[model samples]
Target: MKHPRLFLHVQEPALAAQLLQSAVVKRFIVVKSSDAAPWSEQLLQQSCDLAFIQADQHSEADYQQLLSSNILAEMDFIFVSDGNPEPWLDKLMRSGAGYHFRQPLDMVCILDTLQDFYQQLSSTQQQVKANNSMLDQFGLLVGSSRSMLKLYRTLRKVAVTEANILIVGESGAGKELVANTVHLASYRAEQPFIAINCGALSPELVDSELFGHTKGAFTGALRDHQGVFAQAEGGTLFLDEVTEMPIEQQVKLLRVLESGEYRPVGSDKCRQANVRIVAATNRDPQQAISDGLLREDLYFRLAQFPVVVPPLRDRNDDIVGLAQHFLAYRNAQEQQQKQLSTATLQLIAEHRWPGNVRELKHAVERAYILADKMIEPDHLLLEMALADTTETELNEVPAGVPLEQLEKAAILNTLEQNAGNKTDSAQQLGISVKTLYNKLEKYQQTEP
Candidate 1:
């Protein structure tokens, strides 16, 4: 593993000198604040892995400004103070900083702590790399897009709390996955996590499924059945396609969320609801409320923390990463080692993933199964590619237009249509994805 790049924000000359010559200093690449330049600037100038800040030395305003800027978001901060940190610095530690080192610098102790921290950081990075390699399966959802990363951060914060969450996204965008992630991240992780699709069941059964039924409650109700609310006690109950719930059921759900109490279908005795509620839907919550599909009052009650899952089209940077991850995952599962060619990667990157991550994964898997050692562009059966090139063959290029320019236009046009999915564009152009990438690379060289 590479050594960590570190920043020292110690303002005291003697302490700074001590830290600079410390045993831990030899383990990392450390940059100290030399002049009046902002610590964030110094840190950003290079790829910093971690930072040690003398929180007590900085003013409250300076500390707050540093935090508000979010300059240290990607790295861990270790605060060193002469004594207990000031209230504001303590709050900072509570907010996100991992460790605190008290003053009267214990070099040996500091080195040991630093070693432990490095080990942990290295382990976490490896896990993230592994997760990214798989793409679709990471921290409950697979995505590296800005929207997805923001969603992950939000979930991490909201998970430890008891707040209800509303996940709004398109179908197959992994709303239930978000719910599961929250549950697993929370203190209730050891308990059960029960999920029920509100759209999949009838109105009558929806009530029974969520709240359970007593013995002989209805026809074929032989024994008492624990409802999802009870089954998910001490954990979470994920309500999928929540908009599909009947108005009457919505009222009950709202009541349950509000009072944390519910009744079985046949039993009058009310049971305490210990499970956290996580509701999700593909439809717009506001539109659903306008259409009377979702209760307006219940919408407010469930949306304690609303998380919107971005569609595949909106996450352009994540397409290739997710596609490759899907391919590797398939190879692992089926004992096959198929890989995507460079040209194919470009096509995959260019195509608009209308179905989002779900569509991308399925498409990659389909192509992987058909290809030999390398999954070429043709293996990716994109309908848009076939439709685009049906009339314009390569040899039928119009006169006066340079052949290279025409080829570039065709490639670019196909890419635009497919929303930058390179796999589809390459397939449509009757070329390998690698060849398409090469041509584009050469065009960039000539054009630039």
Candidate 2:
């Protein structure tokens, strides 16, 4: 909010100059790339607020470059054009641009489109006057790391839209929490936010679970039942582990998503599905699609606004802070003065939380329960400590394995260390037994 910075990367020099020189845009700290080169690290570190880029092949190339450069996720681009909304509109939207304004360079119109954005920035600056505040910065999530900040930018853009959102993250990365925050930030906040785990549902009852079943549809259908779609009418339906849904049910779900109409089991009448969908998966979606776990069409429909939640390992900067937050929360809840010992803090900071935030939170809670005044590292029961103290094998990956393969290898090795005891394996890995089972099941299906 400190003199809102706006970068103009329009293809036309005159249009860029016109927008730059306009009195209406004078309130912004307008910056044009001196040589109109690709955005450098220094420029992004300074945090550009708004960007106007020409919607053409050149801009598309530049946009892809920014994406490859890892800066696209942190940016909010407003594609500008001198013509109709053809050819590039779909491409732009798919690339995450929320607005595509036809240009002859209308300054007043630009201001109108950005009025809310400006005020929102000002409001956020005022509310988060210190180092940062969690709720003010991002919905329900704590941290000011670059990845979290990138996530916040994505959330703010997509939350207001009616499109279905697909949240991708590793297990325990808090996908459901992210989905809940998106729901709370949206217009449907006051309405019911129903959640269902597609993987947990009985495969035979999957359809009924999603679209409800009429009376006498099955042996247990004593009366007509409302499924998640009906239960979340006019609100959001959060579909956790969506990739695990039966293929047949995925077909039904995709039909409903595309047509907005669904017929209940054993019912002739079609019901309107007035529900927003927010789905999440722990798997690599492309891998799932390749393995026939998730339908590509359905994935496309669900991922109108795809949100990638950063793994805990990727958010190293927020590790200790998040642990402290959990400790403080527990202290508040139990009316006790408990604190983490310095050594414990170091352990929390160094260990790679493969189980992500959920693991960290659980570790802190376990420590809180085990300790009196000062929580020590032993209270954490972390895998690293077990490996150091016992003959437990380290989570070693092959020299050239893909990044996605590391977690699976770690899980298998842990399960072996615990003598195939699922619960013990899951505990050692800092994940739920269910998550461990799910990963195992998924792996079992893929082995040749």
TM-score of each: 0.65, 0.68
Q: Pick the candidate with the highest lDDT.
A: 2
Instruction: Give the Å shift of residue 234 in candidate 2.
Output: 1.1
lDDT of 1 by residue, 305-325 (tens): 688888887888678888877
lDDT of 2 by residue, 278-358 (tens): 999988999999999999999999997788999888887678878887777778777998988999999999988777776
lDDT of 1: 0.72
Best by TM-score: 2
Pairs of colliding residues, candidate 2: none
What TM-score does candidate 1 get on C-alpha atoms?
0.65
Residues forming the 10-long window of minimal summed lDDT in candidate 2: 126-135
In model 2, where do residues sit more than 4 Å from their true spots?
Answer: 1-30, 33-49, 52-73, 77-137, 384-448
